[model samples]
Target: MNPSPDLSIIIPTFRREAMLLDAVHSALAVPGLQVEVWVLDDSPEGSARSVIEGLGDPRVTYLLHQPPTGGHPAVLRNRGAQLARAPLLYFLDDDDRALPEALARACAQLSASAAGVLISAPQPFGDDAQRVEEERAYFEQAVAWLAQGPSALRVVARLLFGPALLVCSTCVIRRDAFLATGGFSTTMPVYEDIDFYMRAVRQAGYVAMAEPVVARRVGGPSLISACTRPQMLAAYAESQGQYRRQRGWWEFMALKLWQRLGR
Candidate 1:
């Protein structure tokens, strides 16, 4: 088996077959980059098999869960990381399309920087698209006016209280950093990305890119859509404060202090 590629793009899917094909096609089409795309199908029917096989691109590998993941996207995501060969991991959803240039840029940034995670600005689409763009822009611009301290630290703090940076589809993370910090949360069904990515940022800081890398399809058949606003908020509230209670919290702080005092 081919062991290591420039980037490992993991897409976890349930019912979105056609969109999954689009997502995989866009990923495989990334120019001047070698990517291993892992499509994990959590659908019991294994409906994605034929489409993935028909693509016949060695770069794309499909796996059907022997028993479905019971609606936990995090389980499929974490399993992909365990099996992926690349040193860098980019998690993309079945419905989102990747912008080649921005993705390549993200991989390059993560390769050069020591940061654990790198996230690109997202281009939101679908219903309330304009509203989504406005809200995200407000946070990105506000990072400078509302927060103080180091760049990554400010981002960490800003997002911890509320979301400024989102869409894990646009984020690239070093393999070591991902393993060290722990991947997405298995227990929490909704807002699992929030729990996981926030922990990822807090551990080793993050690289925030301005250009949009992912054409995110919001207000669609996604986790947020499946849950009510109150349910989402409740899940966030229950898990937000607890994700940080991990083994590396103090070690991360020590490293931060050493960096601060070094100069």
Candidate 2:
């Protein structure tokens, strides 16, 4: 009934009610923008309903998938995007917190540039000092490479072999552009963000912002943390095969060589 907001912040959550509340609060706190927060709960028992309703925020919409779709953040994210009413869509993890100026800065950058997607370098927070250090190094490398005006091959190469810059929570994309790109892959249980980012960067192009717009909490038993190393490697291998099929074998080989030579 109400008019659409300037931006839609879609947060896919499962069994983390408290963290989802914090994430919603952070979204609401974003300055200088009219934002609608969509909480897509995939919990089996609709556990997040009470928490979302208790917030009593008009701008927040609570969505629960009946008969529970199991633990698939990528699927929920795509569903959220489909239901989004705003021109801009931001995918935020339920455990992460957006900086006060995150949306405002993203809006400014989108308005100033022709790039379809804008990604921020997130600052790692919480208990894991080791993870924080690793993320910092990764962020530094990613920013440096992004500064060089990377091509589609470079984007894919960095995502696969170098420091990955494809954190879904730090991304802000145009609603139309996102829909056109076919959204995230439903088949990928891991590296789905990377898969989506490679396609998005190639189709619409991207801009990387130096400053962090979100605080990524570490040391938690998240989806990434729960996955075994073998599972991760298998997923990466599968993704690489998909990339070759989609982007052509020759381009993939050329890109791999280009990355190797540059390094």
Candidate 3:
């Protein structure tokens, strides 16, 4: 049997070939880390099979499903988590790049803290490819928000409206803690990450916030905010309702509307 890897990097990709390649390279390049990188392809016929195969890393596991089911990133994530042999799981977006020392820091934190459930770093990315000065300011502001406190409600609020540092790409979660929250919800097309984080934080009393782990490439095809307001609002409502029944109507409502709107 293969010895369990120290970390499992789960990246759900659709058709982002070049970006996915970059993510794979980053995962491999992170030194001193023994990691298994699983690419859950949501593309028809596993469009990335050849690419992942070319990477030639024994630690890489490439999987393909039918079109629509493959398109569901959340389901892919949960499936990856279920298959992970490691005690720690890191969910990465295909377009993001992991910092070289991220895994090292995460391992250290996990080793030190027995109580922390989720350990996350800041995500520094520009809204667009140009990488403007304003984006830097925004990035700094986002990191500051994540550094503030550890309230599940506050984390949910930031995930929905603020800089979105709570994205799975920058997070390293304890496997059991993630499984306890039932992983990601595949019911919604969007806001699944936020929904997962909210549930995980609510259940796991503490979530660790460390330095930024991934230099995320924002404004991708799958970004929730890239969608129009109506689509976004609809997802918000769906996610809110789901959170309500499981968590509470009041907290769900607060996260869905009131608190997000700064009411």
Candidate 4:
């Protein structure tokens, strides 16, 4: 059989067809490389299926799960990873767009650091369409920190309780490492990415932050980040509890403070 494409961009989309289309266009525009795009539709009515099919791109694969399994981003993500034709997987939001060299650069980074199981980058974008200067500066710092091996203490201190840990869409992970980590934690109502990242870092021996690979388009109407707060917090607390049980109570308490402080 012929080889699979080099990368699989998995997008878990609800109902944002227009933004999803824009996202697909950006993925298709990622310069040079054969890649597959999977759209995991969780919408009730199969709304985005036609739009995805109309793209007519053989590289695109759309999967719809109706009356969908709720709180299964991890399950959907694992399904995407399983269907992917490549050893490397990139998780993209339905509303995000890749920058010009995002995929190519991520592939290069993975190749260079065969030791790294997960490679993440900055998602540079603004409330407006244009890139903001502050975002650019922050990205530079993140890249530098990742290059230096952000450290176990740092990973625990910063990642265990920081805004930095929750952004899963910016991450590109190795297929083996993802599977080994048991994929995403489906049981957690929130902080699944945090749980996954901690496990991935522990298993992979290394997680590198490459230069910004994606230009994530934020400030949209249907952002997952814009989810209602009480629900989000409740989910966050549940995930935090899980992390505590898995790790330790003291570590969990420290992490909880970080969350409560809005860190």
Query: Among these predicted structures, which one has the highest lDDT?
Result: 2
Predicted structure with the largest TM-score when compared to the true one: 2
Q: RMSD for each model, in Å, please? A: 4.7, 1.7, 3.2, 4.0
Write candidate 1's Cα lDDT for 180-218 as tens digits. 887888877687776677678778777767777888776
Q: What tens-digit string does per-residue lDDT give for candidate 4 at 1-263?
A: 11567777888888889989988887777666678888999877888999999988888888996558664676678788888877777887777787758567767677577544555665666675444555566667666766776654456555655556436766777778787877887766556776677667656755565656677665545434556788567756675566678778987787557556643
Which ten residues in a row are the worst by lDDT in model 2?
157-166
Better of 2 and 4 by lDDT: 2
Error of 2 at 15 (Å): 1.5
Better of 2 and 4 by TM-score: 2
Q: List model 3 lDDT by residue over 143-192, tens digit each.
A: 57656764656766655555455566766778888988888888776777
Better of 3 and 4 by lDDT: 3
Model 4 deviation from the true structure expressed as Cα RMSD, one decimal place: 4.0
Candidate order by decreasing lDDT = 2, 1, 3, 4
Where model 3 places Cα greater than 4 Å from the true spot, the runs are 119-135, 153-165, 223-226, 250-263
Candidates sorted by TM-score, best first: 2, 1, 3, 4
Clashing residue pairs in candidate 1 are none
- Distance from true location, Cα of 83 in model 4, Å: 1.9
Query: Distance (Å) between predicted and true CA of 242, model 3?
Result: 2.1
